[model samples]
Target: MAQQATPVRTARLGRALGPEPTAVSGAVLLLPAGEEISARRPSPLLATASVRALGRRLSRTGREDGLVAHVVHYRYRGWNGPEAHLAADADWAVEEVVRRYGDVTVCLVGVGMGGRAALRTAGHEAVNSVVALAPWLPEEDVAASPEPVKQLAGRRVLLVHGTNDERSDPELSFRLAARAKKANRDVCRFEVHTDGHGLRQYRDEVIALTEDFVMGAVFGRALSRPVQDALAAPPPLGLRMPLAAGFGRSLRH
Candidate 1:
């Protein structure tokens, strides 16, 4: 007899089904909230309210727009482990989507640590855009032979952070955006005022921007130009300006 196959454990991944059948465009790979520590928490793709709201909109619009979406549940909680496990999972998902959909466009939608993984994966050929919400920015100078988040030269990346975020510093994301811009990449960093890491205060606004950016802007069919412009515009705090480089605003603002 053949050996029995091992059972799946501590992880889940699949394509999200829509309300009903509809036309198709591209795909959205969603990585829900997570942490970099070893604590084992429930997968945010299934548990987080923010992700649920975004998922509902994506399901509806995906049916109407005929697009595909997938949510990832990592095998672990932390991303700073030896394997860079989340990034591997993301690479697999992107490859799987391309295998099924051909050489089509892709949008990476991630929150927090998940967003970090998404940013690391957005340089892949199929990925056209990335929307990282309250992302956890990586540290400077990596010991890993090849840095995972280094190939963002030509991709469209959008990062949104809340000003009052106590969990992760919004300035880190802003700094990464500035660095990418300096590298001649097209990047947008939006700062939502007075909100924390969860962004509970402006849930609707966050969802709407994610939907518009992923569905409209990524596909470049509808809601593209305006959403693109809004994202590309400097943050309201004026920190995105030239004079603000290495400024003291990050300490207070």
Candidate 2:
């Protein structure tokens, strides 16, 4: 019998666009999606094509003139516990990015537990915008989590969740958005398809919103009208779902 070759695992590269700012222009944080166990171990949820595509879209924003994108990796609490520890870690990461990068604008993007982390990070001084995908900030956890709304008041936030997500209901995202809006923050919400707590169905809209949010934060422009209009349109479907077990297989490159 012939020996079987073991698959090689590649480090998921965190990409930055534009020159490292002499004074940091802006920073975007990307957190892994899933519960604590899933987050600790590699899973297809984090390596989906939509996830990679979102990263690429964010990287493109960094290529724009006068803007830089800094992507940082952080650990988040999936379903293991409430978000206290994850929030603390997120705060530390945000502060570190600000300290190292200078007075850079900050944007937090999280999917699932990562979304909760992003909201927690929003309490930091440098965070100016947030994009939460199917975030898991339950009402009970809000008291324990940092006051992200206070820190993010008057900032721009885009919340997207799948109505079919069973892990964390989309209505929770809506409730969070409502709180943000009440604080006079610029908030936008989008609903997508899928029942497994993933954002595969809303990839394009998510990417566009992310780009728009970052650009708007750095340059003081309103979200691009086209992007906003597109988001307002009805949700689209038929996106191929990535296999949770096969994510690392595609990283051979």
Which candidate has the highest lDDT of all? Answer: 1
Q: What's the lDDT for all of these models?
A: 0.68, 0.58
lDDT of 2 by residue, 1-253 (tens): 9999966433232555434434456677665565554335344454333355565556555644434454444443244454455555567667777676778777777777778778767867788877777788665464585335666675667777776788887766766666566664356675664534765555554556566666776566665553344334332310111113222222210
What lDDT does model 1 reach? 0.68
**Worst window of 10 by summed lDDT in candidate 1:** 244-253
Candidate 1 displacement at residue 129 in angstroms: 0.5
What is the alpha-carbon RMSD of candidate 2 to the true structure?
A: 10.4
- TM for every model, in the order presented, reads 0.78, 0.69
